[model samples]
Target: MSNTGKSLSDQAVQELVAKLKQAIATGTYQPGEWLKQIDVERSYNVNRFTVRSALSELHSNGFLQHVPYKGYRVTEHSLQERIAITEARELIECAAAARVIANMDSPGLQRLESLALEFRDALNAEDRPRMMKVNFAFHRCFNDYCRNPHLSRMVDELRERGVGNANRGWTKRSTQEASAQDHLDMVEALRDKNLVRLQALIHIHLNRWRQGYDSLSS
Candidate 1:
């Protein structure tokens, strides 16, 4: 543990950013709502400097928008931007899934199986939060073998937004079963080294996510 008044690990930074992004996505901090430095400092139990640093990092990454005198606001996405996100996810995730299928390892398979079970449990319990966690875990399970950290990181950043968006979608027990089954299919595909099926399944998974987003506005 390095001492520097407040030394944050990469994981810690990601968690903090995820929390803030979740807040923004869930309307806790509306699109136009001012993200006060003091409020985040007190709420998150950190100093204004940390808040500023985190916010700056997110802003630079296109998750937050800095207003001239009104503090920061969550960045809003248009339908076009949403579609672009979907397309980008399809390309990256499918490519990663292909790689995972091509270079399947025992550890990766074990991790994917574990994540699939977690997703099933979350789905059975109809727990959106847990399901969200499991869903990302499942994606990362395969993405870890991608051999391209930068691509994997991009998928992760996009997924933070994807999960937030998904939170607003209908996550009833019935919906949960379908989503969970999708995860299982993806895992099975990867485990069998079915590249074509894995790619298609990954594309469908992302399309479903985007469909949920589209349903909101319509």
Candidate 2:
């Protein structure tokens, strides 16, 4: 085994994490394929320990699954699994959104509305990556209203995994458009101060995530 020069720096680990995430999400590394640490180190010119740490972080954040001695694979949760996870996450997220509606000041509401517009522009222009990012930001803004740090952390874990999972399934323009529409509706619901409508929209939005898997495969 050859030396990898030095161990990866903390900043470098974070950068690699983002790079590996995009590569896996974009299918540069296919779902369920083994990721060898030595290969990753060689490919990235990083230390083996760095590769392991990076993979471990991704696994914890739910982007990849560790297969014991078999190493890790980019996660590809089943439709049923997606449904279950979405159901669980929607409860926490919707509750947070309710709090957001109650507590949101003008500036926060403006942020959501801005994100919704960005989401629409991304979709109308067919910029999928930007669309996904804005989508994350929209919900994350609401989650901030929940206030309890512990609950916020719990929701964040699910959001990371669930959003990344949904990214895999979004391959159709119609599906993406529907997602963009949900963002628009969510912003309106916030602006209107309609708690019931907002919670319902949140449910439908979560359900739409599963729809992408069906839409793409069909």
Candidate 3:
């Protein structure tokens, strides 16, 4: 369906994709779990065509896989792949933070602050899903100010592929309280418009995850 005349089509697709992505991130789909289109349609309360479209979108975005006879499943990434994804994301986000500080207006700054607050609240509440959502939102706010549409789009796609791997696998050792502290420090850096500190904070953020993953492996 085209977005031209549809008021809710885009909204519905985004909502459904978020829900499904969250489920996958939290292991609801599990490794190698095959997802039937009919089951997804019923569970999401969307039409068959909508379900198909959403699934296709997810697949194209590296969140889902198709097996010739086995249907669709959540795609899995190896630790090495996860590390690469995290590194790439850090590059984009850290640079984006610097650019945003140099470009975005007051209103844009407020939006970034709002996202950081929401992420902190989610961490305080120990809500993993909410934390992930708002954490991504904060990065997105920075990336939106990147001024390059292609760069913004690439960061978003990388985020989708990295969210589950980053949040679930790489951060298993980071408690909610610890993550909250990290978010607070990041917000403080952003509020001060300290690009150097912002870059450092993002490095710490990703390094913590890498440490956690390495610890798990050892």
Candidate 4:
């Protein structure tokens, strides 16, 4: 392929990767569901090479697991693994809370508040897909204020991994309401530059899904 062709192919692969990741994250592709390459190609209308490359990227990112003599399957985390991931997220996000507060400006705070309100509206309407998207935006916006690209990237990766594990905590109205409130509270904490309160909210927000997951497993 020519350089231009290569660039287009790379872009196609990246787009496919993002689409597949979103599908997996939103539970359209359930945990442990096998993703056949041909089906993926037909579904996404991509070529064989693109599908393979995208699957490989997702596997590298811990979103999918490759099976010998079989295609990729969505990775399903064990309860213990989910707990461990929650703990890790708590540590990283809480530690970054101070930096995020220090770096947060008026514009950033307003953006976060907007996203938080959007999330609450999505929750009220019982729009799961919109809720997922806005919830991610709210948290991502807050984390971006940490002003450390590497740390922010780490948080993104861990968050994607956790979301990929089919955290179904949001199915309950009560849980969704709590999450909505948590986002608003987090925004308030940032606005007030309350590092301690923000850290506490982070812990609660991160573990809410884990608690729901544990309940389901029990």
RMSD of each: 4.2, 4.9, 3.8, 2.4
Could you give candidate 3's per-residue lDDT for residues 104-172 as a string of tens digits? 777876786787778777766767667766766676777788788889878877766765655554345
Query: TM per model?
Result: 0.78, 0.75, 0.76, 0.89
Global lDDT of each candidate: 0.71, 0.75, 0.72, 0.84
In the range 68-175, model 2's lDDT, one tens digit per residue, is 778898888776777678889888877777777887888887898899889889888878767766776777787887677788767766665555567554676767
- The number of the candidate with the highest lDDT is 4
Q: How well is each residue in 1-218 modelled by candidate 4, as lDDT tens digits?
A: 99999999999999999888878766678789999999999999999999999999999988999998998999998877877887888899999999999999999988988998998888778788888888777778888988999998788777777775535666667778888899889889988888889999998888777546656435
Location of the lowest summed lDDT over 10 successive residues in candidate 2 = 1-10
TM-score of 1: 0.78
lDDT of predicted model 2 = 0.75
If both were scored by lDDT, which would come out higher, candidate 3 or candidate 4?
4
| Residue 199, model 3: Cα distance from true site in angstroms | 1.1
TM-score of 3: 0.76
Greater TM-score among 2 and 3 belongs to 3
Model 4 poorest 10 in a row by lDDT: 209-218
Please list all clashing residue pairs in model 3, or write none if there are none: none
Please give the lDDT score for candidate 3: 0.72
Clashes of each: 0, 0, 0, 0
Q: Which candidate would rank higher by TM-score, 1 or 4?
A: 4
Misplaced by over 4 Å in model 2 are: 1-30, 33-47, 60-62, 67-70, 213-218
